[model samples]
Target chain A: MTGGSELPIASNADVVLVRQQVRSAALEVGLSLVDQTKVVTAASELARNALVYGGGGMARVEIVENGPRKGLKLVFSDEGPGIADVEQALTDGWTTGGGLGLGLSGSRRLVDEFDLVSAPSKGTTVTVTKWAR
Target chain B: MERVPILKLGDILIISIQIDLEDQSVLALQEDLAEAVVAHSARGVIIDITAVEIVDSFIGRMLATIAAMSRMLDAQTVVVGMRPAVAITLVELGLSLGGVRTALNLEKGVALLDHVRGATP
Candidate 1:
C-alpha cells in the first residue's frame, strides 16, 4: 500500500486538480471507476470545504488492506476556525452561510466510513473511506 | 452529454437534466430555469433527474432555491426520477429540500403538474 499527501492550494480552483489527483491515486490503488468517482467526489467536497470554509487545508490519500479487502482513505485537514456545533453542522438544512449545508453530511453518506474532528479556533480534520466491492 | 429539449405541454415546462446536478452545472441551470419560467410564463416546471446518480448538498440547495424562485415567478417546481439510492443518501445527509416537489417518474411529475395547474387555473 502506498501513502500520498497533497498540500492545500490557496485558490478554490485548485480543488479540482486535487480531486483529479485523488481519483488517479485511487485508480492506481485498484479501486473501480464507480468507487473511484465516489471517493473523488467525497474528496472534492472536503477539499472545497477546506478552501471555502476552512480557509485552506491539505488532503492525504492512502491505500490500506483490511483482511481480504482493500480500501482507500482520504484525510482532509485544515487550520481554520473549527465547527462550533458538530451535530448541528451535520444536520441537513443547517448551514452557517447560504450553502445547502450538504458538504460534510452528504460527503459522509457517500463513503463507507466517515469521521470528523474539529475544535473552535483551532482546526478541522475529515476522514472518509471506501472499500472495493 | 446530450442536451434534452425544454418541452412545453400547455402551461408546464419540462426540462430534462441530463447530467449530475452538482457544482457549476447546477449554478448555470439556475439562470436557465429562471429564464424558462419567465419566458414561457409556465404554470409548473418539471426537472427530470433520472440520469443523475448523485445529489450533493449544493445541488439540493440549488433545487430548493429553484423551487422557491419558480414559485415567486408563479411557477411550481417538481423534481422527478431520483434514484432510490440517491434518495436514501440525500435523506441520510439530512438535506432539507424543502419547498421542492418530487415525483417517482417523469410521467407522474407531468401528471402532478397538470393537476396543480388545473387547480390553480
Candidate 2:
C-alpha cells in the first residue's frame, strides 16, 4: 500500500465527494474504465451506508499493490450502532433501513475483496478493494 | 446544492444532467421533474444521463422513482446515454432498474417516448 487520503462521510455531499476521490484514485492506480466505475460506485454505496446507517464516519482511500498488480482500497468506519448479524446483513434485499437492501451485497459484488467488522455498540468498519485486471 | 435544469420541448420534458450529483440534488431533480411534468402537462420525460459517470444504488433508485412518479403523472420517462462502464457497474451491483425504460441517446429517448405516446392514444 502507498499514500492515500482520509475523507469525512458525514453528509450527502460527502458521499459525492467520496465517489469523486475514489474515481481519481482508481484512475491513478491504472484500473480499466469499467473497473474504475465499479470501485467508485462501490465507494459511493459504502460511504452512504456509513452516513445513513452508521450515523457518519471516516473513509480512508489508498492505492495498493500486490506484486505488479495495482488496486484501490477503501476503508469506511463509523461509530454508530453496529450490525450484529454479518451474514444476514450481507444477504441481498435485506435492509434494516428502508433501502432496497443492495448496499452491502451489491458493493461486495462490485469489488474484488470485501470485509465487514462490527458488533453491538462497537461501531462498524467496512474495507473493500478492487484490483486492476 | 446544485439543481439540475429541466427543459421543455413540445410535449416532452428534457433533463440533461451535467453535474456530479449529490443525494440532495438527486432528490431535488426528482421533485423538479415531477412538478415540470404537471406544469407542462408533458406526455413524455427524457432524462439524458450521457454525462453521468456513475449510477450507484441511490442514483439507480432515484431513476426508478422518477419513472414510476412520471407514470402516475401521465408521462412516460426514458433514461438515455448511460456509459457502458456505468451500465456494467449497475448490473454487477444488482440493480436491474426493472420498471425504467432506457435508450441509447437523447434523440432515441425522445423517439421512444414519442412512439409510446403515439401508440397509446
Candidate 3:
C-alpha cells in the first residue's frame, strides 16, 4: 500500500482539482473506464459534500495492494458540524444542505467499500475504496 | 473567476464551454444565462460542452437547472457535445437529466432549438 496526496477542499476550484487528481490516481490503479468514471464521480460528490456541508476539509488519495488486488481509497475529513445520525445521512433523499441529497448515498453505491465516522459539532470522516476489477 | 461567454444569435443564446468549469464559474454562468435569456428575449439556448471531459453531479444539476429555468422563461435549451464518458458518469451517478434535451453537436442542437421556435435561422 502506498500513501497518496492530500488536497484542500476550501473552495469550489479545489473540488475540481481533487476530482482530476483522484481520476489520475484511479487510472494508475488501472481501473476500467467505467470504474474510473465511477470513482471519479464518487470523489467529486464526496469532495463537494466535505466543502459544502463540512464548511471545509481535506481529501486524501491512497493506493492499496491487497494481495495483488490493487485498488484506490479516498478519505474526506471535515471539522464542521457533524451529522447526528450517520444512518439517516446515508439514506437517499435526505440532506442537511441545499443539495440534491444524493451525494452521500450515491457515492456509497459507486465504490466497493464504505465507512463513515462522525460526531456532532466535532467532525466527520468518510472513507471509501474501489478495487480494480 | 473565469467567465463563460454567452453569445446571442437571432433570439438564441449560445454558451460554448471551453474551459474546465469550476463551481463558481458554473454558478456564475447559471446566473448570467438566466439574465441573458431575459435580456435578449431569446427563444432558445444552446450549451456546447464538447471540451468538458468530466462532469460531476453538481455540474449535472447545473445543466438541469439551466434547462428548467429556460423552460420556465418560455425558452427551450439544448445541451450539445457531451462527451460519452461524461454521459456514462452522469447516469451512474443517478442523474437522468430528463429535463434537458441533448444533441450530438452544436449544429443539431441549434436545429432542434430553431425547430421548436419555428424559425428558419
Best by lDDT: 2
Q: List the residue pairs that clash in candidate 3.
A: none
Task: Report per-candidate DockQ.
Answer: 0.24, 0.92, 0.57
- Candidate 3 has a TM-score of 0.92
Error of 1 at A36 (Å): 7.8
* Candidate 1 regions with alpha-carbon error over 4 angstroms: A4-44, A83-94, A109-112, A119-122, B1-10, B20-22, B96-98
Model 2, A26-122: lDDT tens per residue? 8899999999999999999999999999999999999989999998989999999999998999999999999989999999999999999999889
Mark the regions of model 2 whose C-alpha exceeds 4 Å error after superposition: none
Fraction of true contacts kept, per model? 0.33, 0.93, 0.49
Q: Report, for every candidate in turn, its global Cα lDDT versus the true structure.
A: 0.77, 0.93, 0.89
Q: After superposition, how far is residue B44 of candidate 3 from its true place, in Å?
A: 1.2
Error of 3 at A37 (Å): 1.9
List, residue by residue over B3-119, the lDDT tens digit for candidate 2.
999999998999999999998999999998899999999999998999999999989999999999999999999999999999999999999899999999988898888789789
Q: Over the full model, what C-alpha lDDT does candidate 1 score relative to the true structure?
A: 0.77
How good is the docking of model 1, by CAPRI class?
acceptable
Better of 2 and 3 by DockQ: 2
Per-candidate TM-scores read 0.74, 0.98, 0.92
Highest DockQ: which candidate?
2
